[model samples]
Target: MRSVLAACLLLGLAHTARAEAPLTLRFVAPERYTDAQSRTGSGPTLRTTIGGLERIFRDLAGRTLHPGQSLTVDVLDVDLAGTDLPGAGPTAPRLVTDVTPPRLRLRYALRERGRVVLAAEETVTDINFLLRARPGGSSSLAYERDILAAWFGARIARREPPRG
Candidate 1:
């Protein structure tokens, strides 16, 4: 009985160790990203922005992916939804206008059961972000998060064919 219990425990431990996160994220040359840093004094810092994005990606993958499916994302560039007005004070809000849309560029790979199923480099943008009816009302990084969610739904979650 003792030996059987030990074997069962070992198996459980091994299974737990083999479980993997649905999403893995990497940011390349974040300093060179177009608009990743905080522009306002009270805005989120660089680390905060990156952390928030990682959380969003992980959440999306967790909700949308199957048990054996995983996604890896390498973020190449980011241009936020709004532009900071020239000479605006540190406390001034980032101005959102029709022309200043949110943009994100990323390379991603989707895998299932240790096999690569899809991969692509994509540039995502929402030109009419401000005009669209968004469900989340003015949350932190709301515009950026919305665009990322849309991209995840259309590309990664859909399990589209790999692009050349």
Candidate 2:
């Protein structure tokens, strides 16, 4: 058993040595509002759920964002019950299967770009958001999809800029 364990550890170390560096995902926003509204919790209703939000992103962006390009999304803010925040609710940290059904709700605000990258404040939420960008060919939906994927720890997508 000891020999087998040693062999396994050696193999694992070899694989690790060869493993590629993880792709870095940047959260440029200074603040991110993450709201998780469970269907079986006391949370409020949201316009969209986490899985629904993920689907929307995939639909919008086609799932292949190259590198260097960015997608900007507007995170809405709301007051949510059962939060860790002070005065969050009568009963905070509620269970997922509680009789209190989690409605579609907006629980927090992501007011700054720096917060998103540095703090991970909004990564925790199951929410929907709008996007803004300069005039470009990729259309809003495509940009959104790419941005969403990037936010979910996927590789980035980029388009070559025009040149003479």
Candidate 3:
């Protein structure tokens, strides 16, 4: 009976070991990554993008992660949707073409107890700007944010426990 009890306890401990905790999000990126060059048209800054990403992850965590899991994001690059004018100097008025979509690249790690369970570097883009035209106050930037959120959420879901 004692042996059976020990085995059961061990099993319980194992299950707990795999259980996740509430997600903690950390962002690392360039300060200039979030700057606005032109008022006519430009994508969000690195910070803004990160905020949106975190919001999405927070929602996903509430629905997916166990409780203590954490995500650390390191933003590498940001290419906003617009064209840089060749002759436009710093003193000249900024003019940007708003037809292009944005691109974001970053590296991230999903960890538990300081041990990384998953790590990846991804480049997210909105070439077609499919989400750009969505109504309800959704901008091209919002569309980009949603795309990143969905992609990241899917990846996290794969590692998360099944919802009961």
Candidate 4:
């Protein structure tokens, strides 16, 4: 009886020691951008944008993921130059962007048990951020990052059906 009780106790301890596996995140951005204003902005390098997005996604996943769930984001393209309007002077063609809004296109999949539970290709853009200003400079990237965080946060929180 004593040996049987000890075995039972050991099994219980082993089960208690086991921890749930963490959700996994995979980010893929094969394209590169050097001229985007965000690269010149105050956030981070455009080359490292994938890393930045991964960090943001991880933070959001912490609150949104359940065990056995995973996410993959494939950034197909990025255009941070926004829309360019007509400008003045000989350099008008170069300096003509008074109201530029960032644009991002990506495909994402949320999976569980080896099946895609939710997936979508999304494009996000906003010109309203142009009116806002950064603390020290005119880097549109900072505003774009904030916009991305909000957009992604809401999507992760809701886990809604795909919208084209």
**lDDT by residue for model 1 (1-164), tens:** 99999999999998876676668789999999988776555445678778878887887777888998878899999887777665565445677788888888999888898798888888888887877637656665788878878787878778655344
Worst 10 residues of 1 by lDDT: 84-93
| RMSD of candidate 3 to true structure, Å | 10.4
User: Could you tell which candidate, 1 or 4, scores higher by lDDT?
Assistant: 1
lDDT of 3 by residue, 71-143 (tens): 6666666565554454554334223244555666767777766688978877766566654435563443455
Ranking by TM-score: 1, 4, 3, 2
- In TM-score terms, which candidate is top? 1
Compose the digit string of candidate 4's lDDT tens values, residues 77-112. Answer: 666544323333222222214365566676777777
Candidate 3: list runs displaced more than 4 Å.
1-29, 32-64, 81-99, 131-133, 159-164
Give Cα-based local distance difference scores for all models.
0.79, 0.35, 0.57, 0.57
Question: What would the per-residue lDDT of candidate 2 be over residues 86-155, giving only the tens digit for each residue?
Answer: 4455334433222222222212221122232211234222233223322453331233343344444421
Sliding window of 10 residues with minimal summed lDDT for model 3: 34-43
Identify the leading candidate in terms of lDDT.
1
Q: Each model's TM-score, in the order given?
A: 0.79, 0.22, 0.52, 0.54
Against the hidden true structure, what lDDT does model 3 obtain? Answer: 0.57
Better structure of 2 and 4 per lDDT: 4
Candidate 3: the clashing residue pairs are 20-67, 21-67, 21-68, 21-69, 22-67, 22-68, 34-45, 34-46
